[model samples]
Target: MINRISAVFLFLFFTLNASFAQQVLTFKGELAPIGDRVEILTDSNSTMSLRSALSSKEFKRSSGSQFPNLGTTPYSYWIRFTLKNESNSKAMGIQLTQSMMDYVDFYQVQGDSVTRTNFTGHRRPFNNRFVKHQTYIYQVPIIKGESQTIYLKVKSGKQLTLPIYVGSIEEVVENAMIIDLLFGIYLGIIMVMLLYNLFIYFSIRDITYLYYVSYLGIVMLTQASMQGYIFRFILPAYPEIADMFIYISTSLIGIAAIEFSKHFLSSKQYTPLLHRISYIFWALYGIQISLAIAGFHNFSYTMMLALAMVSAVYVLYMAVVIMLKGFRPAKFFLIAWTGFIFCVIIYVLKDFDLIFHYNNITNFTLLIGSAFEAIMLSFALADKINILKVEKEQSQLETLKALQENERIIKEQNVVLEARVIERTSELHEANEELNSTLENLKQTQSQLVESEKMASLGQLTAGIAHEINNPINFVTSNINPLKRDIDILLAALDEIEIVGLSDSTISAKQLRIKEYKEELDFDYLKVEINQLVKGINEGASRTAEIVKGLRVFSRLDEDDLKKADINQCLDSTMIIANNQLNNNIKVIMEYGELPLVECYAGKLNQVFLNIIINGIHAIHTKFGSTSGGELKIATYADEENVFINIYDNGIGMGPETQKKIFEPFFTTKDVGEGTGLGMSIAYNTIKKHKGQISVMSSPGEGSQFSLQIPIHNNQSLSHLN
Candidate 1:
């Protein structure tokens, strides 16, 4: 009975163990090619594991196409498969277990679709459905096996049948978060920079800033969309736009570079021609954009490449211009453009797949170039501001200096004007004093001239009266001489008659007595006495008449009347009138030549001659006094143009200093009371009135010569004489 009980317990235990094993069975397999079938059969298994012949001793069971008999809840399994390229080209496919596929989906990342596929508990027909999100479970049969790569994406949620099966899930999540965060930061930085530059452009109205902002915006959009961020969220409907963004970003970058170069380096200073070329590139870029919008992306891309090349050439030209111009920004621009060029080359190489890495280096280089460009552009802007400030200050300083100089000049002019005013005032005062003195002297000279004229007129009248009295006295004297003679004869006859008186013896005796008385009475002595008296009276009368003539000539009565007169005759008359004063003290020499009868005021000219002769006589008298004698020479001659009278004196000659002032009014060497000082002055005035000039030549102790030059009458009659 105890043996039977132990057998029952062993059966129950075996049954229970089988149920547990069936409930938790696991399978392992390998995806291998055997003839025409791809099988997953395990090489070894236990009661708790699924039955499979997929693994071998030579190859470990890395993955399988199917896993049957795997339990539900609390059981976990993973599968791996190696797909090979059965054709010459690469094959792309996916492998997953049916249970895991129920909650998972398949997505083709290489095409322009965002479709999803689900894998469920059962295998579905592989119909190559293009629109459906279906898992591709089929393998690509290999002609000559070449390894390919794909992912078996497993979706794990709360309803997942096994513990989450994933490789480095945390790492993937962290990497995705890092990429998102980095992209966000990059976008934020780009947005901030773009907005900041836009604000700057608005504030400054600089087109360069606008270009820079646009370039950065395009760069951010290209990077964001290129990484599928924009496709994932923002505009999933237009996946092709990302490609256009790439080209646009590139073109914008080139344009920005050109504009920045122009702004920073002052393109006008050097590469004006190249700047025009850059503008052409910009126009080409516009054409490229047009083409791109027209859906000619390839042509647009080609044109963009050409534009980029042109931009590079322009950059190089600008670099050369900057180097020649010696701008400091050239170095920075050159380095930045070169870096951009390298970046573009790398991007091109990356597109060709000749390079294994993405164009991260290109991006890095572009960033570096942008940084340099920004720094140089900022420096250039600052330099421009500083230069403008300096110019403004310099202009102001120059203006101030000019004002100061003008003020200084005005001040100097004012000082000079003041000095001139003072000088002019002083001269005016001196002129006024001289005028007053001259006025006083003129008054005194006028008084003296009037007195002299009065005295001369009185002398003329006195001489005329004396001449009339002399005529009467001479007549009386002549008559008295004859009467006395007759009286003497009568008295002698009476005496003879008395003596013969008393007789008729008479007449004969009386006549004889008268004759005797006439003989004896010294009638000759009586006659001599009477004649002496008469001769004396006659001499006195003749002297008086001569003085009257001199007075008349000196007075120049009727001098205004114009008449034809002989110059020699006038001179002779003057000499005759002056003879008395010049008789014994001075000798007169007349060298008279033949002259015309000039039309002139004869009386005035005669007066002029009289004055000059008298002056000559006085000069000689003053020279020799009464003790010595001097000669006064007078000459008259006529030339073709003039009738000249020369009055020369061998007397005390005047010095040059005295001769120069000799004709000046009131200027005389004579004592104050001795001369009226008008003789030469009157002569000079009279000669001037007659349109004649009187010139004097004199030297101290050598006498003086006066030449009176007068115009000769053309119609005058000349008498030729030696």
Candidate 2:
């Protein structure tokens, strides 16, 4: 379909050339005076009398006032010279002369416009004489000087008189045809692009595409109209349509430019103020459109000025903003718009006749601007896509890194947890073994205690029996002593009776009496001895009872469970238990302060205190070499919420490295058999159970201070204490 349309346009263009060719004529002849009228004699011997030709009805002559007043008759005439081959070549070699040269004016018509051929000013002919004959040649060509006749018209006005002649018209229709063909091709490409972009706009509903389509349409139409194609073709039937197309195309171009800028620069994003200015230009474009519709040509030109000025300012502003914003596409846009602005300035200059050349500035501006605009917009689209791709890639990379980091952390935690599990298992096994050993030792001690109790009961029974036996033996001995004394007394009494001489019969009666008295006295003395022996046995039994009471008080075996026990009492008990560890070489300094009863496992606390004190003594003993005296300070104190026990030793302190590992299980500085390495570890655990904290501060060559703060009550109380 397009090919067919192209063929038709080509044919019409050639046909117009043919018509322009046929209308031109060329004239070459001689002017001579024959009697009262001048005669034009051609090379072919054809003579045309000037007066007769002027008298013909086909010729219009001016009145005497219009003719030049010379000293001779002023006669002027013109004729159309039809030429052969007028369409194919430029007319050449024809001439004209003045029979009387005072005043003459010759005008030739070309394409509906006329131009004067007469010389003006001092270059006019010097003599007003009619020579016998004057041969002249014309610069315009005749049509092969064959089939066509030349049209010659001569006119004399003012003070000039002459026999004017003309050559044939030079045909330019071929060149016009070539120019038209080129313009057609250019316009066709632009139209196709416009329509294609319009289709894209419709399909995609993108305003940018729509803007470009409108821009192309307007620019193409404006170029075509400005080049006079509309007058030659589409508007031929309506002559006014030629002028109207110019205005309309101008206004449309303005509207298109504004719309294109708004979209192409993305003015709304970076320069909202310029975007609003674009809207103002858009409103002015509406006015331009209205003026074009009204066929106001001057108003249209004024609109062009306004459009140029405003658009130039706006484009410059947009370029600056784009540059400041670092928009790469604006570089191309700036160059293109600057070129268009220069072209518009040139066009304005030419329109007012300030310049002489044919000004096709609009065509050049639109061509270059559109080309650059298309390229830049393509770059912009590509840039946008690239940015999105980069962002996506970065996002993916970050996500991958996060996932890897999470996995690494999880792996590390798993390793740490695994190690912790192994350590805890080992610790549990060690604790179990210790518990079993302690249980076995407790059983053995219980057995020993039972055996000791049995022995004690036997000893008590034996002592009681021994005491009873001793009491009877003592009683017999006492009785013997008393009898000896009484025997002495009786001998003395017999001596007295003998002196008085009442001998044998009296002695027999006295013997019976003395036997009775001896019996009574013996009984009384035995009772007194028994009482004394019983008193000695009672005193010995009382001493044994006191010893048993002291044993019971010291053991405290009945109160073994956890209880609110005085921390001071626990400290004292622990001190007593650890006395062997603390020899006289280490002075025990007790700074016992007022303390409330603490709820704790008293036995465990005693064990913890014993371990700590024993450790302190060891530290002191190691420092002083078991000989040099050292001081072990022990302190107990209580506040509203917690009881504190602090044991400090003036010993060679440990370094940080040793201190850090001090509480680790199986870490000890003592000899293998002397230290189990469980003391501090067990102390830490027991303190934890009691909801307490322990911390140490020490330096080498300086004493160590170990502080233990346990809650006075339960865990809640400790928390409140903190």
TM-score to true structure, per model = 0.34, 0.34
What is the per-residue lDDT of model 2 for residues 1-722, given as tens digits with 9 covering 90 to 100? Answer: 33443332232223233234333332233222111122222211223342333233343222222111121112444433333433344443333333212122332333322221332111133221121111222444334435432334332211223323332322122323444566676676676666766776676576777777767777776776655455444654443455566666777777777778767778889888878877777677778768657645445555666676668767777877876898765766676676666666554543333342222333244444544454455445445445657888999999999999999999989989999999999999999999999999997875565345334423433454345445545545555555565556557656654554455557667666656655745646655655655565455555445444323322345655556777787776555445545555788789999988888767566656766676777788888986867989988888899988889998888889888987776578888656656667767777887788988888988878889999987844322110
Q: Candidate 1's error at 70, in angstroms?
A: 99
What CA root-mean-square deviation does each model show from the true structure? 32.4, 28.3
Cα error, residue 514 of model 1, in Å, equals 3.1
Worst 10 residues of 1 by lDDT: 157-166
lDDT of 1 by residue, 140-180 (tens): 22233443212222322111211111112233234345546
In candidate 2, residue 356 scores what lDDT? 24
